[model samples]
Target: MNKYFNIAIVTALSVAITSFKGNAMSDLSQYVDPFIGVDGGGNVFPGPCVPFGMVKVGPDCGGKDWNAGWDRDGNIHGFSNVHVSGTGGGCKYGNVLFAPITGNLDMQDYSSPRNNEHVALGLYEVDLKRYGTSARLTALQRSAMHEYTFPASDDSKIIIDLGSFLSSHERQYLVGSEVRIISDKEIEGYTRVRGGWNIGEPYTVYFYAVFDTPSDDCGTWKSHRVEPGKREQYDTSEPTGAYFSYRTSDKQKVTVKVGISYLSTGKARMNLSEMNSWNFDEVRAACVSRWNEILNKIEVKGSDEQKKIFYTALYHSYLQPVDKTGENSKWISDEPYYDDYYCIWDTFRATHPLFTLLTPSKQVDMLRSLLDIYRYEGYAPDARSGDDNGRVQGGSNVDILFTDAYVKGLKGIDYELALEAMIKNAEVSPGDDERKEGRGGISDYNEKGFVSTKFERAGTRTMEYANCDYAIATLARGLKEKEIAQKYMERSRNWQNLWNPDVESLGFKGFVWPRYSDGSWWSENDYSVFQGGTWPDFVYETFSWELSFYVPHDVNALIEKCGGKEQFTRRLDTYFSHEKWDQRWYMGLFQISNEPGFLTPTLYNYVGRPDKTAEVVRKTLKERYNTTKEGIPGNDDSGSMSSWYVFHALGFYPNTGQDLYLISSPTFEEAVIHLENGRDLSIKAKKASDKNIYVQSVKLNGEPLDACSFKHTDIANGGTLEFVMGSKPSKWGTVGVENQL
Candidate 1:
């Protein structure tokens, strides 16, 4: 960034920070702004969506029929259903149709700014300044508590529209309504929405409504087709538009109890039966209890701000990876019935990995969910996946996850069942993952073989042979998968074929010498490798460099290719120094921001430069992670990025699928990890601060030790790693696996 940009960001952030000094305590909800980046970056909606649920139940951003929460002038807009307030990609979600607007169920009423544009977690209340009315609603997972305060005119009516969900309109409308009045205070109705992707079959949903105390009401049900062109005809809004409503009486202060059902209208009525009275205390208590149970997983006794960020972040991490609250396994995949909200590529790395730690049991259940998806459709669930058939987007990260889990020793629920899922993921033939959309051609060497990028023809070959390569090698060498392992291990070394000498590493290069791979030349025509470049044209989302030479299985071979330990160490030094490296591209060690580069910080030990590993770990933690908005250095692929922080901060990394990590460095004076299993792991480093960056010596349980990393087994067995600090690096540790290439 330039000096001017830096100065402005600091000035803006400084003012914001100075004003947030009131309460600095941890309670999960306080630290969350939910609006910080929701304005423009990616209309990622920030709402009360629970961990693992499919629906993104939050404040509607990207506006609905011109209604948005954040105005360019920083004013708040109306709170609509199906909100993706703010996220990276600029996209919108379901609106109107099913969104029943109470008082003035007309989109034009919310065309301009009004006073009632505000939101709250667990509860959201906003006023329609123009209409002189207000609406407030809270939820308890399945049920909602609503209170709308409006003008005393008897013409006011609460619209009950079963077809509204964000932006579904006009020609796309397909709703089957069966409305019935149960009592003056209650009504049960069903709205079946028929649409797919953009327009498909009608999916059914039921609504159960209950009024506060009682009300004089006889109801008639009607279906309305949306006019997609209603894109803010209020003379102010444009393509930014979406809204829906059902008109009903507008009594002064009316209370409502609304319940939605996916089964039938009768089911929605049953929901009303289960929740009759307007029990504010009961609803609030119920919501709190659910949050407490999920939040209690990894408790932090830190400052208020830390707790908020931690828990809320933990909240973000847990959201959308699995089906925490669903029917059947309480989680369902699209392949079974074809649905929305499945970004497997984005969630696989960190999200699923993090889920393993928070809900271990859920892992098997998730696997079963995948298996069930397979049973239903012959393939594991891809994004809108068809189990074993059809091409999907990106690599099979689930494959690597399977191995990583087994190696980490996280097992139980159903080992056999889990293995079945793993086998299917590996064996599922590759067709088109990482299509690169309209782009084409080959990527750099590092881009090939990566599970996600089967974009180009060769890219597919690289992925096709990668897992069998790892599983085979790991089976024979690491996991002891002798017979079947060797076949796969040999294939795993395919990464070596793409290796070249010019840039000194593996790159995606076509044979014929004139072409290249990893460090070689890449065809600009190959858009498949555009995002994550193969060897020569390495292009990675976090950066091409990180992924360019990421071959975790062959560090020793890399040493030989680079010349020797000294040359290899010199390269390591370049990554940390962050300067003075010859380059055409320099995106911070390239893929340092993604999972491919996660293991990079620990490779120093393999080249006899343990001190470098320590330095990177320290710098990375302080630079990338903090108590601020920009704290997340990269897309938090679930928890892998954060999990990377957790593991590295403690001073080591899981090096290979061995699940064992080499101790490189420490970031704290003292830290303790209370394991889910009875035992606790403690880590302490002395003289470990800004200037004191080297490990003078390390001791395990007071006994002097060698090397910078430790094995997971050793820690799991219950032990501590103590370190002595110094201004210079120490090289007396184990001769170790100096060059496993």
Candidate 2:
């Protein structure tokens, strides 16, 4: 670890430890460093939120377009009420902003040199140095509590902006808005915007704001002050809002609660009713308790730095697919409502499986939400924000998410309806409706067994659809729906059609290459410039060679395609040999920063080379991840990367949607996962250290397990998995036996 990381870890440990000084003991949330990904490509918003809560309350530094809200190098624009956690494109949510000022209005945006900044799970606080003010934030499921302390001044004012929703690629505007001064101490209003992450998705956010101490003066402003004590209705698309100037004596702390709802202002008020009093400490404590309940699901014995990374990773994992069930009981049925799936393409790989181990009940509700959305909206939602579905990536990938939950034996969902949704998506062509509900080029995929370059990113789309097909088939077979299983199972092999046995560019036989509608190759000279900069869109942010290894459901078949095991091993060696990363290519052959490349490290286990898997996984974690602001190599993608780290650090990975978890040498001495089934799965990496990054041998419940993989039941049923670690790789888990798919 570097000096900054050491300082960060020690400081985090000190806070977590010192929090227990006056109190009897401490909780895991204390060690969470929300700032780890703020500066890094992690692109994570450090803010106040409960686990899967609908509200993400945080500061929006207003970095031109990047979303995560807070930027280490940017100025503090104002604190916004909502944010999409760890996403790439432009920022989303962040409507209903509140900023504090003293004395003059100071129309100039404050350059907040952040000080005394501390953030844990469910809580965030920062001192605005320029304004000499402090802001602290905590959240409820649908509401947020903000406490601001201003210097002794009578001019302390709180400004509420109803116009600026988070900046996006397509700038969002307040098409219509209404502000009502409900009373001397309360106000209720709402704003409507049409453009967010899903460019044309309409979103209307309602908020009910209340103050502990009534303001002496209140007025409405649009670019400038307009009226006082009057309910204002603004129909034009312009910057509009209200401000409450307080009459404070000295260091008067004011507490404010804002409840948000997608339903109506009444629902927002009801959401705010949960905070019965103006007790900031009480609300803060309650937020801490809620976070602890979730973070305590896992316990690990490791260095303070390791613990910080693990706990923070877990914290980031639970920040999305927020529960919007409380939005309005009337608009949505009694079924669960989850908003901001953001993108299922980024999440299904690890986030869903991690939920299976930790919170299976939430997974069931989330599945129910997907089904409900499908029943009402004619299709399951993929990358959604608020209530609208945006352009999807990777071919109706929600099939993979729903199927992953169902196959895990989770209850309380309409499985038949879910399967219906999956099949409907699989069969329906994309152009059948203007909304683009199902798979694009599905007709072509079904007829030709492969998608042609006629559609953009044909290679990426084909592989993603095949994976979804495999997941659906697996669920269908388990449910004894053999006809559905057989149909989709045949479709799952469509990836084989995209394989070109003679790819001169890759200097190998049988690599996945794009072809035109007539089965002619669409060749590009430099495959390294696959996407990103200085490259035409050859692939969707991935090299054809990297995606060629994307047959997750049937890696054995992929091995066969590469001319058996020996040649496959040589290819794997060549893939990892390139240590240099070009700007055109985000990362090298094993793009640890991206999702398609996540499962590549685990491919070694299939070739009876679990040692190589162990080596690669350990090195990736050590070099690519850390406990700093610039920690992650790329966007966290709503905790997909974080969950990837959490599982790998525990010495296992859910390499696919299936139940099998590939094992490796854990970075921790011991890690314990407390499953929802009231069982404790303990992973003991004995003699584990930084130098000891290889698995010498393994045992499950005192029985020698020779295979490199274990069933999900092994963890869910819960028992001890012990691994003897060594400085170098051992023969353990290197057996040639492979699990039949």
Candidate 3:
């Protein structure tokens, strides 16, 4: 009998297993806890949304820290129709709010304490303590359905706040807004706002809402004053909203459907066709079914806690870089258009690679969307939201994203056009608008072979740009452009320009140090191992020790620079074992909370120490992650962090912009990844447990594997990777270490 079946039997004896709607007990959505990352800095939206849906309808609490518009302990402000999931930094998209109340309208005091909250895939319900009402939220692709059950009152009303939005630490100003009541049952409005993560860039959101029944009275409000029976209100810089008052009996239920669009109110109204009826449960069931379709791509047999974390991570991974296929207002194209990348600097490591395995078609569409953005917008954005791009953290990491897809043979993208865009990022600087797109300080990088101290984040940008150049070189070689390929291949070594063999830290020599434009290094007195501060610093969100291990394309060179295999392995050990030194979020020198350190734990494979890699990865997976409100160690970074967990839990981690997966210990007994080519890539670990965590042996399709790595082609067409586990580390993948190098 299968180990999973045996475990299931044992679990069933101890607990009751409820079947989902008389279907198979294995409904994947049941394992997804939407509230897992709501606390900590995870900033995950715990509400109702389908896979990559534009309408992330959820309750918005007032605070600078609610980047995704929902906080665990915060009171309910209102349910907004637009939100980003698992993102940090500046807040965006809490627009077109609908708040239900049973008494006099108080714009400032309408927020209610919420309790009995329940969040699942495609459903969110919470009882508002102030109004004694229950709000249930569900969503379609571009619209939302809200059902509010209220207490008996003659003044029951639903307030449509056109000016309300999730404010961030950055300055957020409402440019203008308008609300027009078409009937007692209907209203249409729009809000134009600027300044969030997009950094002063303006975007407009138009909404059309309809109630299930006509109201007894209707009006509009500007700031604090309410004009009863008013049909229209237009204002700038002040709060504006519309209200529909109704006389309600005890436990009267009211339903509202809201559709939103970036183009115009007409399009918003047309988008409402996605949910034609007022059957909230029916729409919610459909959303749940859609979620199941995606989550079913990967099936795992593990403990219920393991299954919950895995499925929830999978669910969060598909939630963004949203599918705005027909919603683009900038340019019309038959190709798909996606926005809210929130930034590729974060997602390129793991999230996009996971998409390539599970949904290649959608991945292709997103790649094509990046190309489309480059076609009209001059360059593809590194960080995009609200139909605009503002921040560029690190290199034009989109180069890596495009190359990762190209190397994996994901079709439908114009690779030649993509190369052109990549070259633009390599060769040209975006000048004053460099923060929005393309490489900043490219003139210096192309001329000096390294970004220098004159530029902010010089050391980190140089390393990331080198990696981006490697991506360009790889793509160019695939396209048969020998000259371009060779040129970029040489430029990809620019990271070495910053390598100073004299700089020492934590008993390890030769760190990548900051340098000046004139080929001089920052003095030792001014530099520390953890020198860099956030944003406008020599490195972004990380220090020199962590950024030193970010060279994924040329690990051998990195190993050689660290004084060969033994020294590199010792350095990694020190990195993992060092005492906590500062207030930064890290374990030793490994900052599991950030993206820069994601690949560090797996770097041990290069030194033929797969055992150490397994040790660190399994330890991190156990200690740093959980299925709680504060589950994630850091901001999920639009599912980048969650995808990192998902990949590692399945016994592999992708080297982005390359076709490699480094082997790690499997958390589950078995995991089956359903490929896009109508095949299943199954991974099984025998005698795998908390104690039996080291791989004693591994076989690919019944053949013994010597190396701790596998190429994408190995499982592209589907195969079985079986691992024999043991309590003690063995030299299973230690032979033929040179092959890995």
lDDT of each: 0.46, 0.77, 0.86
Residue-by-residue lDDT tens digits, candidate 3, 1-741: 011223433343223223223334345777999999888999888999989999999999966769888876678899999999888777887988899988888866799998888887778888898998889898989999999888899999899997888887775678878899998788999988888876847788999998898899989998768899888887666768899988988888889999999999999999998897687767776677678778878888889899999899999898998998999978898889999998799999999999998888999999999999999988977888888876898999999999999888888899999999999988887988778888998888999999998998898899999999999999999999999999999998899999989988878899889888898999989887777566778899888988888788888899889999999999999998887665245677787888999988888888888999899999888888899998998899999989999999989899988888889889888888878787889999998998988999999987999999887878988999999999999988875233321
Q: Give residue 470's lDDT in candidate 1 (0 to 100).
A: 72
Query: Superposing all C-alpha atoms, what RMSD in Å does each candidate have to the true structure?
Result: 9.6, 4.4, 4.7
For model 1, residues 1-741, the per-residue Cα lDDT tens digits are 011223433343233221111322123444433332233222323444434433333333234331222343432334333333222222233432222233434543323234544433343555555556666555554456666665655445554444344442322243445555566566665544443222333544556666764543334433333343132111111121222222344445666766655655555555445444464434433443345445554443445554444454555555444342233222354422322323344454445555554455565456555556555544454443101122233344444555555666665434444445545555544234333111123233234433222333343334324533474345344444466566556556665554434332232232211133333444445432224432333332433334434566666765666667777676666555554233222333433444556667777787667777777777776566555434555444333455566556556666544555677666566755544454556677787666677887888866777755555556654577787777777764535443322
Superposing every Cα of model 1 onto the true structure, what RMSD results?
A: 9.6
Of the candidates numbered 2 and 3, which has the greater lDDT value?
A: 3
Task: Point to the candidate with the largest lDDT.
Answer: 3
* Order of quality (TM-score): 3, 2, 1
Give the least accurate 10-residue stretch of model 3, judged by summed lDDT: 1-10
Candidate with maximal TM-score: 3
lDDT for residue 323 in candidate 3, whole number 0-100: 90
TM-scores for all predictions: 0.70, 0.93, 0.95
